[model samples]
Target: MGEQNPLCVNVSTTNSTTEILSRYDMINWVNDCLHTHYTKIEELCSGAAYCQFMNMMFPGCVNLRKVKVKANLEHEYIQNFKVLQASFKKVGVDKNIPVDQMIKGRFQDNFEFVQWFKKFFDANYVGQKYDPMEARESTIIWGGTPPGPSRIGHNNKVSASRLVHATKPTTRKASGLDSKHIGAATQTAGGAEGGGSQKLEDLTSQVSKLKTKVDGLEKERDFYYGKLRDIEVLCQEREQRNGKSVGTEKILEILYATKEGFAVPEDHVEEGAAV
Candidate 1:
């Protein structure tokens, strides 16, 4: 990407309608005011004697450390203001207010900016209150065994045990019948699996044949491309050789015409000798 040109501003001491100042000029003026005091308009416009009147303001609730943090935040705000100034310059606006005046007007009747930063700090501060009782309850619920009927419930436990024992051999006989059925299913499945494998092999062979044909076609295409390139080179060389020959023929024809025009007549030479 090409580099963008820096924006230039025309500075005027007198409040003249002819000369228009830009947002960049206002930012520069504000930076100048931060350094020194100015009496003359040209001195105000120039780098020498502009005033430093603004100081950092801190909330009563915050400590010295918080004040330092707020100072950093103010620096970031100034940087953002500079970026806004650049955006205004890029779009070439016709008019602009001074940076200090704009800030003053925005905060004149409102404390919203200050209140917003206060709320931001309050929300982000991470001093969570600890609760020992709640933590213990949670640990017990997570780590302890689940509550239910114990082994001392004698009648119910004994009855369940007898019922499980009585059904055991009947369960074994049913499982034996299921095993026989599964053996027949296995034989049927083996036949289907063999048929699927054969179909897969046929597909694989067809794919290999198609791949070989495509490779052959690609090789043929490359061969034709090489031939076309060679033909183009030969045509260019022939045109160049023909052009040189034509130029030489034209030069020789001009020389022959000049020689014929300059030749002396035989009768004129005889008349001069007689005289």
Candidate 2:
């Protein structure tokens, strides 16, 4: 849903015409958003233009209680909030991110939009930073290698310790605050981690349900196998009673093995003739 509707999701094109959004860029932002905002997305951050677009599509996030977000959306199209919202509002799409993806969507136990905002402004809205929540609970940071035409340095590191690092701009210069408000973000990250654990438990429950289904299928397979074997045995028994190759041949072989050496043929030995 980037740029406009009917998006070519997963489409491959390095041509200039294609508007590319990479998943790697979204990891920090998605984590930060969740850490910063425990409230429903209806009360999410301030991006007026995006707000304008989203309000148009999902007029009421109140009624739409559940949503399912894809990994790609969270890690790729996240910067395009309106587009993400519109996709969710589209009649067929769900608005919540599933819990299975929630843990994976984040960078740390605690992170949020406020943290992401700091990073974003610091990074100067670099193409290396963009994200969106695709579902009620799920978030996928696209870990796959950069696609062709994709930016090369989003995942590079400043040092061995930092897999990737983005130095945020100073609050004194931008917001006139005494220090970076990132600590406030850090405080909220704790709650995000806790929420993440709960979501993981939900996924565990789903796995248990799937295991139950697999066990039931195995039982059914055993039952059907027993029925087939019984049918084969019945067929053999009937063949023995009647006459047929294999079954009948087996009976003849047994009889021949048991017979005394050269008994006169029953037909050739005439009993007392009924003259």
lDDT of 1 by residue, 1-275 (tens): 87655332322233342234332343344334232221111112111111011011111211222111111122433443454344435533223435443232222111222232223223332434423223222221010100122112343344322322222122234345445555544555566575776655565565556556654554454344333323333343454567545654454333223333453334423321231
The model with the greatest TM-score is 2
Candidate 2 lDDT by residue in tens digits, 47-123: 22232223223344312122222222332324434444454455333234222223232322112332332332333
For model 1, the superposed segments whose C-alpha errors exceed 4 Å read 1-192, 244-275
TM-score on alpha carbons, each prediction: 0.19, 0.19
Where is the poorest 10-residue window by lDDT in model 1? 47-56
Steric clashes per prediction: 5, 26
Q: After superposition, how far is residue 160 of candidate 2 from its true place, in Å?
A: 62
